[model samples]
Target chain A: MTRASISSPKPALVAAAAALSTICLALAPFVVREGDLRLMIEIFAVFTFAQSWNFLAGYVGLMSFGQQLFIGLGAYFVFLISGKAGINPFLLLPLSFVFCAAFAAVCAPFVFRLRDAYFAISIWVIAEVVRMFISQKDWLGSVSGLPLVATRGMDRTVVANTTFYFVAALALISVFGLYALSRSRMGLALAAVRDNEGSAAAVGINVWWTRFFGFVLGSGLAGIAGATYYMSVFHVEPGGAFDPNWMVIMLFIVIIGGVGTIEGPIIGTTIYFLFRAWFAGTGNLYLMLLGAAAVVTMLVAPKGIWGVLRSRLGFELFGTRRLGPTNHRSSP
Target chain B: MPPVLQADRLSRRFGQIVVADELSFSVDHGQCLGIIGPNGAGKTSVFNMLAGVIRAQSGHILLNGADVTTKAQHERTRLGIGRTYQVPQPFGQLTAFENVLTAASFGGGRRGQDAADHAASILDRTGLSKRSDMPAGALPLLDRKRLELARALALSPRLLLLDEIAGGLTEAEVNVLVDLIAAIKPTLAIVWIEHVTHAVSAVADNVVAINFGKKIAEGTPAAVMADAAVQEVYMGAVMDVAAVG
Candidate 1:
């Protein structure tokens, strides 16, 4: 039997790009202004959320429109624990993730019964149910919501810089985690499941288990982003926390950047931020423009910007494609 | 010594159409059972039941003495049953290597380097090694069928169920496939449902003929093909022309 070269190509390029981004983003708080730092924090939060959604919709073929369920739960979990239980806000991140994951596990069996369009709507309905329940809870301040009181005593600069660094770290972790997952054994099963569930089953992939993992992991990441965002903002409300617009924005980013590839979310989020900055004063018109852009991207480049570039230019930054000689003459 | 797969009293119907009526058969270890029928004879339904893709109204499916009637498709796969669809179903965006690797790792119970090596070998065996890096969606029909067989083989199944894999192949391509199946027959059992008579007869040890969900003839390939009942069912159906060609 002849051995094949299975190692990913361009390891150096991936490493260098990772290092450069880490260094530049790590020093942003010191070099960038406070207003810029705030924007950066928002970008990082959205990046994390978009990355999670991309993983679910792009990789696992579960197009959930109810990601707000986790975001709201994460922010609420932070509020309940830190505001009532007196835990530090920063320390509540893991608790928030656990809460969202457990919630997702409970929801999976019911939501999985619906497929394609119904599945997407069922998640939105579940999120609405959760939102209504939270709105009616008196201890959680009902519809008014609660403030993240734990950070009230911290120094302003310290809080801002720490939150900035935390968001940056979370963004990096989410990307790296998903990239690593796409290279693992479970990742291969997920790709198969995404492509064709019937064939995936023929190949011994437990479709339910693979989808459950994606749902839980995606929810947990969304929760983390929510918790971190609320921690920095110092406030949380059901309306803002569980807004359906979060799902729309995520879809836009993943679709515009390129679904199913690691670089897609990153590139999509960057372009989204640029568009947001340009239309900052346009209110709903900004959203309309984004929607139109998404439509155009889908029409012209159905695979998204990164997908077109990958095929046309052989430009792969994350090494998702298999690399080797296309001929049998070269033996490994 | 024992049969690798046994379907006892399997019966299913869709509304007024009976897909399988008291269908029963057994495939012994290393045996090749060819199921020949005209279109709509429910050959694919039988394959579906054995592979756990569909449920039979009242039947017992045993694999190596264990009752697996209620097992899900993936569980049956893990229990050593693998199947190919009548139409090839490759992971469209994934590379051919990735597609086979999924089967080797998940279905065959191999891991890491073992799965990669096994996938590479299967691709080589299927004459798909050069096209391994190409996306499965980009492959032509013949390569797609080859990928389907390669993916099934990666499962390392003791019992393989093939559904019309040779339907679209040319005679020369069918011969190549027959030779490949013949080469693998000594190691595991295969239950092939084919509209192509010559291809099935060349590889299968025994042939069973069915019409309207009921078995009409069973014996060696020659005897079954020559059975009057089998000939009558094929008279109006296109099987006569298929058999001749």
Candidate 2:
């Protein structure tokens, strides 16, 4: 609550809070049930996805509709390589990030030529192309999915706990890592570019390269989270892996939680899962309810649930506001 | 040394409307050149060309004797050319301090404590020290204008382009701005395009008048203001220029 204040908490207070959070996270796997552990892993993976997209939409001033591209590419990279090379898929998680980053770097020049919605839609088009290419490649699985080749008979609890650890690390990175990045020099550049590209250029920030860096970083984070996700299911296929619905869920979590704040995704992910638990059985109604919730949130508090909370509380949990209008709280 | 900035035979057109027509000028070190024209006379287009926001269809732009005609806008800024927009475009989400700090580090190429101190000095220099922590988007017009100037100065520019920075300020504020520019005038070259004629006349070492993108008059501020061609281009130039005070 004090973090919402203009004056950041003392360094000692910050360090203490960080230590506390680390202890709680380390203790969770020991006490949690296997089913609940799997659920928590999904929640963290989804939260990481939302956080990455939030970073893109808010700080980097990019709205990409093709985030699923990296998600599918990440899942496929681990699946195909692990099945053929017999290396543990978990061992290849870092490589998944590398593959996605390299892909984003290659696509940046072509996609960057378009601005706003066109730029966003071009990414979606690329994802579709790649999905189609993979669907036709027999070695890549065709229509049937590939199973986890190595570590198939590993202890169930061990596999679950290991996945939980990786997802937990990623979730923490999405929060603290993103906050630190936003406070860095490159963060200042990202904010300038987000607010106005013309002014950023005039100030000598290389607008293209700055945006390129953000795109690559966000894509890499999403890639790793996606790998952790599919690795748990032990199956990787084109249809579900590259599904645009993944983009929809990510967009929903970010927009409903607050597009830019790290804390927003946490609150949003909680609400999203609750809504899913209650409404998932409603078939198309579940999606419609999600759509309606988004519209209402946009209409009421365009900044999202966290935005409203921050405004009311007069403090931000993880305020790395590098772009948009700053809300002024009246001094008493 | 060669002139700090030189625009040789700059020409451009939008379809049939010529925005710049064989325009040529130079400003030596420590000089101020004022450009004045009617609302649509392409005064800003000239500044845009100089700032590399827009390229000239023909001719060359030289900074310190090197041709910079093909360079990008950010590259031009790094090479010691800094500019302000007609409408102040401060990074709204950032505090006034961060705005200038970004320019100091990126544009001025300073590092660490140097950049921080430089940013503080610029904010103080622009009379924005008290509002250093305030978000720039919430600042009033005068402060925003000052911030615009401060951000440009943070670039440690060899040449500064001022595009109507004084447009929306009050009489007192404009005078304050004039004083600030005059104090800094000895260190670098400046090309200022403004409709606030009196403000221009106060700080301009030299003046040029243009209409339809062609230079109609160029001489001492008083001499150019008194030119018949300039007077015709701006029938109100004499009365309006003298009346602002």
True contacts kept of 2: 0.48
Model 1 DockQ reads: 0.65
Best by TM-score: 1
TM-score for each predicted model, relative to the true structure: 0.96, 0.94
For each candidate in the order shown, give its overall lDDT on alpha carbons.
0.87, 0.87
List residue ranges in candidate 2 displaced over 4 A: A1-12, A321-332, B236-245
Question: How close to the true structure is residue A31 of candidate 1, measured as C-alpha lDDT?
Answer: 97
Summarize candidate 2's per-residue lDDT along A60-160 as a digit string, tens digits. 99999999999888989998898899888889998999999999999999999998999999999999999999989899888786777776878887888
CAPRI band for model 2: acceptable
